[model samples]
Target: MPKFAANLSLMYNEYEFLDRFAAAARDGFTAVEFLFPYGFIAGEIKARLRDSELTQVLFNCPPGDWAAGERGIASLPGREEEFKRSIERALGYAQVLGNTRLHVMAGLLQYGQDRGRHLEVYLHNLAYAAQQAAAHGVTVLIEPINTRDMPGYLLNTQEEAHAICREVGAPNLKVQFDLYHCQIVEGDVAMTMRRDIAGIGHMQIAGVPERNEPDTGELHYPYLFGLMDELGYDGWVGCEYRPKAGTSEGLGWFRKVMSNKY
Candidate 1:
């Protein structure tokens, strides 16, 4: 089985953010990921991870003004400075938490906005972020979010994200391939994973259509898990899904898969 990392951002909502680390650890998760750690001091989160004996695998850079409806500012024009600041802030947290991966969310595009301009800005920002992150031995990730859930999200396809990585020309910059989003935008999730595994820094999974637990949706996750093992993907597979019921109660699929591996 691929190494599974519980995504505290979407899972384990039953507990407070700080408490989710121990909750995930208690449930047999050796690694964990979250959306942002900016809300809490880095030391606070680091302590939780140490106490729980869990590894921090991934977390996103600041998505500017998340409460104000901003998904990210990396691809937005006129926010280059803020985007750079977000990367700096995220790197600080990553260093403290001992996480090597930092996801950079491409903010949404507004009505009638020029996508060409946004792409230019995004490429430049990613290059800068990657260069800075490399010095700390951290990898920068860009995820292709499905527009269905995030209508205006700037990045929406694996091809697009990979192309952006190529344009950025930074070795540390890679794709955060979310299988759930890939299924929505482009259906051949397995083939995409096999073909692009080299450029992929991390991955996330959820059931398609409902974005629920992997076992409850259209995607056949068992096969995908096997495929990850076959393809020699050594990165952490983030369980970024909304539990159909309670987080712990809905982990039967995870338990079964892990048992099979053992």
Candidate 2:
């Protein structure tokens, strides 16, 4: 069975950020992931993970100014320095937290912007990140987000992400196959998984349309979980979704799955 990582950024919002670690562990999550760790000191979060005995699976590099609506700055022009600085900061946290995977978000495209230039910058920046992260035994991941939820997002499909990975020519760089985004941009999530399994470093899932619990969505997650086992994918599958009701109440599917696993 695929190991599931509770996404604290979206789930368990009832508790404060630091307190969510224990909450997730109490609910049977052996591992956890979140959007960003910059808000708190690395040692503080590390202590929580240690206390909870939960593994830190993944987190993103800073995405420029998140509050100002910047998703990421790797693909944006004139922000290369800021992007590099973000990577350095993230690596410091990863070292302290014992995290090995880092998701690098590709920023949105502006109207009338040069697509080719953005691609160039993206490739260049990702290559740098891969080189730097490799020294720490970390793998840098790039995810193809759906344009519907994140309008103008630079990357949008699995093919595009894998192609970028190939062009970057860095072995440490891989794709974060977010099934939610894949379903929105293109159906055939299973087929895509099979085709790109080799390059996938991590996976994420959420319900389509509503982006709620997987059991509440059109996609049958049970089958997907089985498929991951059949394909020999041993990476953590991030539960990156919003809870329809309370976070704990919405975990019926997860609890059932865990019950069956043991």
lDDT of 1 by residue, 13-67 (tens): 9999999999999999999999999889999999999999999999999998989
- The worst-scoring run of ten residues by lDDT in candidate 1 lies at 253-262
Q: What's each prediction's TM-score?
A: 0.98, 0.98
Error of 1 at 9 (Å): 1.2
lDDT of 2 by residue, 1-262 (tens): 7899999999999999999999999999999999999999999999999999999999999998899999999999899999899999999999999989999999999889999999999999999999999999999999999988999999999999999999999999999999999999999999999999999999999998799999977898989999999999999999999999999998999988988752
| Candidate 2: count of backbone clashes, pairs at least 3 residues apart or interchain | 0
Candidate 2 collision pairs: none
State the C-alpha lDDT per candidate. Answer: 0.94, 0.95
